[model samples]
Target chain A: MVDVNMTLEMVQASQVGMKAIGAGIAVGLTGIGAGVAEMAIGSAAVGATAENKDVFGLVLLLTVIPETIVIFGLVVGLLLLF
Target chain B: MLKPEQMSRLLIVASKDQMAPVVTELYRHNLFHIEDYVEAGAEGYEGFKIGSPLPGATEASGDLVKIRAIENAFSIRSEDFEVKQRRKQSGLQVLIEHELPAIEQEVEGLTVNRSKLETKLKEYEQKIAELTPFTGIPGDLDLYRGYSRLVVFAGYVEKEVSLSVPHEMFFSKGKGRHFTVVIAAVEQRSVVEGALQEAGYQAVPIPDESGVPQERISFYSSQITLIKKEIEDINQKLDAIKEKHADFLVACEEILKVQVDQTEAPLRFATTNETFVAEGWVPTNRVDAVSDSLTNVTGGKIFITVLPIDLEHDVVPVEYDNPSFAKPTQMLMDVYSRPKYAELDPTLILSIMFPLFFGLILGDVGYGLLLLGMCLVLRKYLKVDDGAQLLTVLRNASFSSILFGLLYSEFLGFELPWKPIMFSRHLKIGGGEAGGQGPAIPELMMLAIWIGILHITLGRILGMINHARQDHGDHRIKAVMANFGWLAVMWGLLIVIWTIAALPLMPDLTSLPKIFINLNAAAIVGAVLLVTGVILIARDSALEIVELPTIISHVLSYARIVAVGLSSVAIAMVVNFIAIGMLISPQLEHITVVGVLFIIMGVVVFLIGHALNMALGILGGGLHSIRLHYVEFFTKFYKGGGKKYSPFGYKRRFTED
Candidate 1:
């Protein structure tokens, strides 16, 4: 009876570990999403700035707009962990 | 000193003959910005024709072209090539007239001869390749040509064709080679060529030579070797010429370019049959010096008159006169827009704000150290031409990050041993008695908003100062009224927002009566200031009232600083949690094999996670900082579209003068 209870307790603890794993997947995927967004915008920003530096302010703002997505991901992930 | 340099409009009238001398004097002074002279015939102000370039201008440009060619040939640069001196004008003239042309002619002759040799050598190689297969055949005494009826194809034939051809017509069967020589009739030529092609045959017509194929091969081979040697010898001579004339070419180009520029300056002025009128802007302090020099040089025949301020006509060029620390920021300003000549130079403020914003967003000591180390490495080793100032800005940002890092007690998202002097919501900062609360999103937001208020206020103040400093004449009151009204409105708006945002953060001080009183006061002040600003602004443009939201948005934009910092720290914290969990898990301690594997996995996670965080930190921190300054801060006071003051002068590289 004691052995069955110990095994049941291990199963419960392993299930609890799934929360951390879920948080990891969420943040990791969103980070990738942000990276992909930046990849497109960053190239365009570089190209625009190369041609006429006046558009730098606009380009910088556009390029970092995707950063907000990552920040949102981070908050959601941190909330899950703590 | 805070404003752009003062400029005075100058109109100089000089004789056509004296234009070159006068231009030389102006360039020597290097304080004049020549305005392009436009024809005013439509408005009925045309007697002065646009000045033509002087006679010497053509010659000087001609010399410059030749010098450039020589420089290209030798691959000479002023920086790399050590010039003996700023070759005197007469020395350059002599070289241009004598030595340069001689060396050019000599090099041209050698190159021409070498090319001829190369072509002959290539022809010989072609003959050798053709004659190589026929070396087995003995005779070559013009035997392969001038035979239309015989259809003599003295070339390689298929081995199968060898049997067929010898039977049909005379042919040579090569020993142990795939192709053989063949001779066939005109009627059989098409059929024979078809068979040859099927057997993968190729044609090699015998050359018109008077020797056996072997002897001819040897002769061509020897000639090719001799030609190659001669070409090598010519190359050595060319190398000698390059070494001798490279520095001289660079120096000559600089001196001649200056001459060409001076001689061409007349084209910007307006000239008639006898006299020319040169109109341009010169800084006020240097105007007297320019006037004195032109007078001294032209024997006082020229009259330099300082025209009164022409508001309706003149577009004053802007020259920023900032100290060295702020000079790099000037590049950033110029990259965006040059401030109007009448406005304040924002270089000093940008130099401070840009790095601080960068640091605030990237508040971690480890990353700062990495950045500093990378910068030191780059500066120490790389010889970059354009990115030097970028490195300096990065270094300044790195330093600020380090300072903030210490205050926040963060070193790669790990809390430092010492207590944090400044609180950061994203950091534990310290433990037990030494620590306070970690990051709270609301408080961070409030702090960001407050910083935004301070930064934008400074911009408004500077802008107001700029307006007040302008020679508004009778419009000064209106300028002050509008500018001050806007300033008051911004301050009032900040107070109203702060009172609400900081209420929860200041929970201890929150009371019903105090909240009501503060809210009432802030609302009244904000409403009054907004009404006053709208009234003053309505005098200029009622459209500006539509931009009320822009002010609020600019302040809200500062939240990105805290948001980006929080993300950087949170990602790092997550990385550490996973990594440390792997190493010190209670479940895995007894299982040594699993523990070892976990440690490996943990280290990889740590590296990859931190690397990702680092990249994002740089991109977000650097760009958001720049965006804040350019959009939020610069819009407060700065309006770009100033003409860059470029005086007609040379920052000489190879020459002293």
Candidate 2:
């Protein structure tokens, strides 16, 4: 019975470890995802700027929407670390 | 190839005498105007207007004299003298004719001003180009340094004194063996060579061969840049002036609109009532709202009517009213509607089946969840119209995917640690047990077949209802007989087949004479009733001989459900095989990095490929499902030959006609 309890605890620990690893992976990939997302928006914003300078605010707002996903992932990772 | 058949009920009220008042009223309504008039007959009894107001005109009438007043109180004049009479009494002809030349002259003057403005814009662009050195440096740099042995870097020059000193000095250290200098820049070369020889004693003279000119090529690039800035400032001033001119352009357009309205009003009154009556076509569903608006506008003076537009008949009858719904009810209705006749709606069976199939093909809870989330996000925020509509459809699909995901017991291509919902508990089973222990193939197959049967039965029921509503006595009878009687027969056949197959294994049940007697009696009764129903249905139709073939084909259409379900399962199997094979490879085991990469790639490929396949399959299957309803089911009972409604109003396409 003691052995069973030890094995169960070990499995639980391993599960937590696996979850931690997944969290790290999610955070590490998020930067690359954000960069890719911003590349298209940045180029589009530059093009729009050439036509009308007033579009800068709007372009900036739209470009930042995708970055929030990465930030959320980071927050989750940080919470897990603590 | 159907020609539009003209309605025989129309009547024209515009005689030569009536044309004057009609034209005046039309102009008063600001519906149309006449621009230019030409006499057609010797008596000037017939004439054509060159320019008329386009359709969709809406404005208050101008202060032109009434044509009706002139006709009512005018002296007798020769046909040729009609213009003089019109000018003398009505004065409207004079006002209309006078306004034309003045507006034209104003427009011509504005055109000239616009050209001048355009030229000023071009001049400003040239000035801006000249002001910036960043734009001019690259082109000029090549011209100044081409083939010159003397190198200049940040105002420092390196000049060659002798040809015999080997061309290595021109290039940076270590790269000299690859580079050979063909030209040298030198001033008083013999003196420089003597000094060099005194220092090293190996210097020799060769002809001065540098391509660079002796005098510096000076140009006022900076001055040009300043001038360009000044021009840009001038352009800003010009832009302000042009904005003011735009108001004048708007005013001129308004004047032109008035003039065109005056010209065409007479023609519109004379022609539209006779040629094409006042009519507007709107979406069938929006008819009530449009009619209410029309009634409110005219204070119930104008008549509002409806007609269902039949594509097959090419006829729009005068009395068919459509039901109001924001979305089309049937999957087929979306495609068959007036605006989207070319696109086929995939909402029918495909709507439900596609997501189910996709869930089966994908069989991964994690991927399904991802797809659902993505679809939801796109639907909520994206400005794309079709994509948003598709997301709404995918919402329904996601539910089916979730259901399938649970059944497959997969989460991101891995079996979940927790027990699956379908099985009560985990069985100690392998693939060899009953061929594959996950799900019984016979059970799944039976489910697919049953689904097909139910779908076909529903379609037949709908057909019978539609036919009954039409009140076509014989046709209604036929629809009922074929739909219900055949279903009964099919059920009886299934029972007999099942009993016969099971009898050998159950001797006690088989030996009972009562079971056989009941089965034979039921089968005979069902067969007789079905044959009678078919004969009854065929009694009134000309192609009664072909009724059996038609009925059989209709029944066979339901088989698609089973076929589509099986294909979904097959696709899932293939995806699983590829993912599992890649994961378990011996070489891949040692190469952890490659193995991880392969797993990720496999998961990604599986997710995308299966999802796309599911989406497309759903669309195709949905369309086929709707087709089954429209052709097989609806044909059994419905006769949709109703006409659409149209009312008199400003057309949508032209703002001012």
Expressed as tens digits, the lDDT of each residue in B86-173 for candidate 1 is 6566666776788878877887788789889999998999988877776766566466666786566555554665435432334456
Q: CA lDDT of B268 in candidate 2?
A: 36
Reference-based TM-score of each model: 0.72, 0.43
Q: Per-residue lDDT for B187-268 in model 2, tens only?
A: 4345534534443333122212222211112223444456556656545544544443333323233333444454444433
Question: DockQ of candidate 2?
Answer: 0.02
* CAPRI classification of candidate 2: incorrect
Question: lDDT at B402 for candidate 1?
Answer: 88
